[model samples]
Target: MSKSVVPVNIADKLSQFSELWSQKKVAVLNDYEVKLAKLKGEFVWHTHEDTDELFLVISGRLTIQLRDADVVLEPGELYVVPRGVEHCPVADEETAILLLEPAGTINTGDAGGPMTKAAEILN
Candidate 1:
């Protein structure tokens, strides 16, 4: 891991990317990674069998569509989708989010397709 004691500026880091649905790595905590992502529209319905996925809304609104319920999140709010549960995230407009999960967790989870991207570390 890159050594740095300075605090990460979320807004400054978020400004480095413009692509939607792509997760950019910001920090690492033991075996977990802290990520930032820009999301819009609805994501694929998927399940992370080995890890729980956390989504913290930074801007705009997000709706986590589960098999039987929907979790709505606004800025400064967060939700955790438990392991093995199928979920689809939706955003009506451009939304910025913080994600926390085990290292190497795929964005698309078990439903791998075109949107399965390995999170890139942001320098």
Candidate 2:
């Protein structure tokens, strides 16, 4: 078997990708993948049927919109969107975020709309 070394400094690795909304995967194990994302503007309103998504703000602010409420997360703050709960994400300015979710969780969820990303943000 070939052996390879995985590097440290996930944040530094994440910085290599400059595309907006594209998620750079830092690590993965079994059924989950840890990712870093740069977010701006508005994301589609949607929900995951089988998994909850964790969002941790690394820099700037992250706003999560629910049916009747909106939660704003600042740096060092974190939020989890429960499975099957509809939500949208918006950032007035550039924001850096970390996310943990099942490997196949879809960003657009079941509700596909104009804002749905045609491609999965993977690197």
Candidate 3:
């Protein structure tokens, strides 16, 4: 039998991954990965074919642009974009965010542009 321990400080776990765009994975269950991302500037417009993505602003503001709508999220705010919806993230300043999505979800989706990054998790 195997048992897992709950983390004491999510913020500390997040601090472990300081690299840009590299996610820090806190936990995984079935198909979902709980991750933390530190972001700045603009990310490529992309979409996932298999699952929706949830973005929660943890400590800074983030702006998300959908095909037709522009949403700004502040600390304690969250949004979910349905699968197959194209969207881009732009942060004028450094921001920290939490993400919930299916495992194997790509950051750039089907459109691998210049901004496409090979996903990596910080240990």
Which one wins on lDDT?
1
| Model 3 Cα shift for residue 106 (angstroms) | 0.8
Candidate 3 lDDT, 1-123, residue by residue in tens:
675775537688766776776676777778788888899988888888788999999987899999899999999999998998899998888899989988877778877876666556545
**Better candidate number, 2 or 3, judged by lDDT:** 3
Clashes of 3: 0
lDDT of 2 by residue, 33-118 (tens): 78888899998888898999999998889999999899999999999999989999898989999889988666688987654553
Best-to-worst order by lDDT is 1, 3, 2
* Clash-forming residue pairs, model 3: none
Instruction: Please name the candidate that would achieve the greatest TM-score relative to the true structure.
Output: 1
Model 1 regions lying over 4 Å from their true place: none
Error (Å) of candidate 3 at residue 80 is 0.4
- The local distance difference test score of each candidate is 0.97, 0.81, 0.83
Candidate 3 lowest-lDDT run of ten:
114-123
Model 2 worst lDDT window (10 residues): 114-123
By TM-score, the candidates rank as 1, 3, 2
Clashes of 1: 0
